[model samples]
Target: MTMKWKGWALATGALAFSATAMAAPPSAEMISFACAGCHGTNGGSAGLTMPSLASQSKTAIVDAMKKFKSGERPSTVMGRLAKGYTDADFDAMATFFSKQKFHPTTQAVNAAKVKKGEALQEANCSRCHLEDGKEGKDDTPVMASQWLPYLQMQMDLYQSGARKMPEKMAEKVKPLSKEDLDALLHFYASVK
Candidate 1:
């Protein structure tokens, strides 16, 4: 009788656990499907002007979304779109994107600029961006293989004060001539 009772209790416990799990909210992958239209499947952007989200740190994605929601970050569409999501949704989407593989952008670059950009990246940006900008530390987004136009747009925003950047990054970027900026862009796009 004792053995039978133990088996029955185990089965009942398993059933209850399954019920609870089933009752939980939609998963991160499900929530992330909504982002595919603009961000591409699994956070890789196909659009030249849109920044890809794959492999970016979860903190980076969440922070950007939070800023968009709060109007702390300027955007043409993100600000409006961000208003609809709950914190849980933001977290879920971030988690989903952070785990996806980064698909590097394929585009033409000036070989001379690429060489100069590589040197510049090593000297100035590698501390946080690491791996030729293929890797990011903490909240830093990956720079390697990102779209040139998108990068250019972002740099322009940083220069114009339309977007905020970390003080150190701004300091490093502020002094660069336009040619230097172009070289940096070429270098980042060259990273595979």
Candidate 2:
């Protein structure tokens, strides 16, 4: 090849390489790591209130992220975080979390709490959350495996009207006294 033609070919090849690199999507590990700052590595959070995302259903993750992005769901940090991602990004993150195994942790294991909470859950929250609090195999998120502090915080948000909740969920939450909420959190955490 002529020197001039060779130079042009090299330039073209370089450009193609760069473009190819740019076109590739971020690995699921990389994407999940970005969330690990708060969500913990592999979605197993050690924080008192952060929820574990590992092994959660994809639909649940996608829906929550979409709600945060659209401002339909009330959140402090999540809305801003969700706004930064596209639907496709959310899907990828959800899929990543869904594949990882959930590592459940707990602090309080009062039998009384578990017993009372079970009764309360059966009466009011069983429809969507299911009897196991795993949220069934549906679009709804899991509860039994969530952090107790986080669960309590979310419950408080609903009860105090600080955060918006689904109408049906809010209605069920309305009847829960402070004690009931505590017991419920305890029960769920123990099962996890």
Candidate 3:
């Protein structure tokens, strides 16, 4: 082959290799290192207050990080941490956690409580959290398979006006009755 043709072939091969490298999956070690402090080794969080990241959607995870960076989602610690991440870093982290499988909760939920919870979740949560409470878009956390105690506490915070979220969210939950809260908690706790 002529020199110019050989050069062209080399360039094409290099481009293909670069694309393949970019598409490779992120390493487990990198994911673990980034999440160890709050989410523990297996995606179970260190405390009840922190949400588990395992089994969460890649889209939801990235969206939350974007919200934190933009100051739309209000969390002092998360905002600060998200600010330092580049778009590429956020994508990598989201991809990493989305692949981790979550362990099932062993605690049993009461039947009456579950009935009430289902009603509350259907009325107030379905819009954003989706019918199964597993799919959420644009910075909303998935409630399906989430820790029940953690979910309950967040709801209480929202109801008591202790947790400040987007204005629309506060407005949505403002009218939730006590029965509604109980029902919502039960419904989410029972979801796999």
Candidate 4:
């Protein structure tokens, strides 16, 4: 090779190496990357039951991970999955997910169910989750447009004591029936 070409190649190689070195290692990123398989790319899930993590509040994600790890929340896999992550990993994953845009899913809903849910929400749920279910506070989560099954399961957990709940929240859930939950789920599923 010409001397000039060799020098150019060497500089390019050095630049590439430095770029790679400056970036965090794959394992550090894997802590968040591991969720893509199930949560979908950037946490926009196509699964009917899988909850979307994209655009979720970072505080909500971190809190949930801590809850799952501490045995304060019930889950089929999240509890076990959370056990593998450290606080830093959880925080990084939360930040990664919170940056993504949240696109609402198209799920069928009944008018009657939505109406009932709207009532329930206006009365109790909206105080914390807001009318659109995005969030009422910084740490609160966006419940709007989440998968119905996942929302229902969480409600079930909260109601059954499988998940810890404050006394005030518990009181509100105490009066809920199956139909009530279904209505609420349908309503939130339909929101943007």
For every model shown, what is its TM-score relative to the native structure?
0.86, 0.80, 0.66, 0.81
* Best-performing candidate as measured by TM-score: 1
Ordered from best to worst TM-score, the candidate numbers read 1, 4, 2, 3
Q: Model 2 — which ten-residue stretch has the worst lDDT? A: 15-24
Better structure of 1 and 2 per TM-score: 1
lDDT of 2 by residue, 9-120 (tens): 5777864655554444787776778998898888888898888888788998998898888887778899999988888889899999988876678575789988998988
Model 1, stretches more than 4 Å misplaced?
1-24
lDDT of each: 0.87, 0.80, 0.70, 0.80
What tens digits encode model 3's per-residue C-alpha lDDT throughout 6-44?
A: 567577775455555444455655744667688766565
lDDT tens per residue, model 4, 76-99: 788999998889888889888888
- Candidate with top lDDT is 1
- For all candidates, the clash counts are 0, 0, 3, 0
Worst 10 residues of 3 by lDDT: 15-24
- Model 1 CA lDDT for position 153: 95
As a TM-score, model 4 comes out at 0.81
Model 4, position 103, has a per-residue lDDT of 54
Model 4: pairs clashing at backbone N, Cα or C within 3 Å: none
| Shift of residue 162 alpha carbon in model 2, Å | 2.8
